[model samples]
Target: MRTNQESKRRWRWARGVLGPFAISVLVGGSVSVSSGFRESELQCEEAYAHLEDCCGALHGAISCTYEEGCAGQTPALDVVQSKCIRKLSCSEIEALGMCDASAWRSDAGAPLCP
Candidate 1:
């Protein structure tokens, strides 16, 4: 059995030690989660921009090729594919564009027009 004074002193010590530790952990966790959400939002925006650029390029290429009646022309295909690859990477296909030209051609997927 401890004295009343000793019990009060122990309680105060425990509160002083545990209170700051708990607060620090809560604050740190909140900050980390907030940062992660911010980064994800920025990435989403970038992906959307890339997708729009790729779509515009594809539309232009298709219109040009169709008007010329050369849908199967290699030069038109190369130009369109090059523009598509430039706006996106192979791994970002699902996020940035739909075409998988990089996976289809090993040497022709580097976003360079010949």
Candidate 2:
């Protein structure tokens, strides 16, 4: 049986050690997530450079990717979408852009975005 004084001492010691450890764990996780998001954004920007008249759709995807609940789906929807656009020829990109502004629909037949 621990006395009140001993319990308080144990609590203080645990807090002293665990407080910083918990904060470090949180901060470390935050740093990695933010860095990963930034990296993905950078890649998206790079992919966007090769595209023209498609920023609207790509920007919309970027916005969604950063949205609170939507972030879980794809940390880099813009990057993935832009990469898909990059795979198309200039005429195809132009056609897709002219067809819809937020044309971010996935192909029914394909596993990835069309």
Candidate 3:
């Protein structure tokens, strides 16, 4: 049996991705954050970068690789939808400016943005 003093010494508070703070516990010698963490709004460039990553993971499934019979999946698509897209508002996503996108190149050697 451990005392309150002992337990207090182990667990510590961490800043959650959301505005609210959450409790983080040291498990197996590492800290594990509680669920429901939402990070702050990403800058346009940063959000674009994240979209690029998602697209990179998804592209293989969308075209060349899949057509070549090298079948692969875009795991990051869900990540982008849930983490990046959902986190940002329509205005923020619009701010990423898909049509005028110039940040990343596409699989077809064109701009990655829509």
Candidate 4:
């Protein structure tokens, strides 16, 4: 009877003490996973705006898509290129061989214009 009572006490301790901790950890991990890409998305938007300014209005508007397990990382190369294009004047796009709206569409995996 004593052993059974001790077993019951241990089980209660595990449930009462460890359960909330486990739950909290799980919840925290989930939150991180869900929110991890938020920063990248914002950066993507900023890069898109830069592309619009340089490439032309809505020109080379890339939709930033991130790889799985790549959370809070820097924007992808294409997005980075969008920002870099800001150094180029919009009027110089054709002269510089830059195609208008040639950005890749993240969802369709194809050129935005084509």
- The candidate maximizing TM-score is 2
How many residue pairs clash in each candidate at the backbone level? 0, 0, 0, 0
lDDT for model 4: 0.58
Ranking by lDDT: 4, 2, 1, 3
How high is the lDDT of residue 3 in model 4?
95
lDDT score of residue 21 within candidate 1: 99
Instruction: Give each model a TM-score.
Output: 0.36, 0.40, 0.25, 0.39
Which prediction has more favorable TM-score, 2 or 3? 2
Question: How do these models rank on TM-score, best leading?
Answer: 2, 4, 1, 3
Candidate 4: list runs displaced more than 4 Å.
39-114
* Number of the candidate with higher lDDT, 1 or 2: 2
**How close is each model in CA RMSD to the real structure?**
15.5, 9.0, 14.1, 9.2
Instruction: Estimate, for each residue in 1-114, the C-alpha lDDT of model 2 and write its tens digit.
Output: 999999999999999999999999999999998776555566565555555344343444332244347435543345676577567776775655533434444432212346
Error of 4 at 51 (Å): 17
Candidate 1, residues 1-114, lDDT tens digits: the string is 999999999999999999999999999999997765333334434433454454433232221121225554222234355354446654565453354334224354433322
Give candidate 3 regions above 4 Å deviation. 1-70, 75-81, 99-114
Per-residue accuracy of model 3 over 18-69 as CA lDDT, tens digit each: 2242222234224334321222212333453544553433232221111124
**lDDT score, residue 67, model 3?**
17
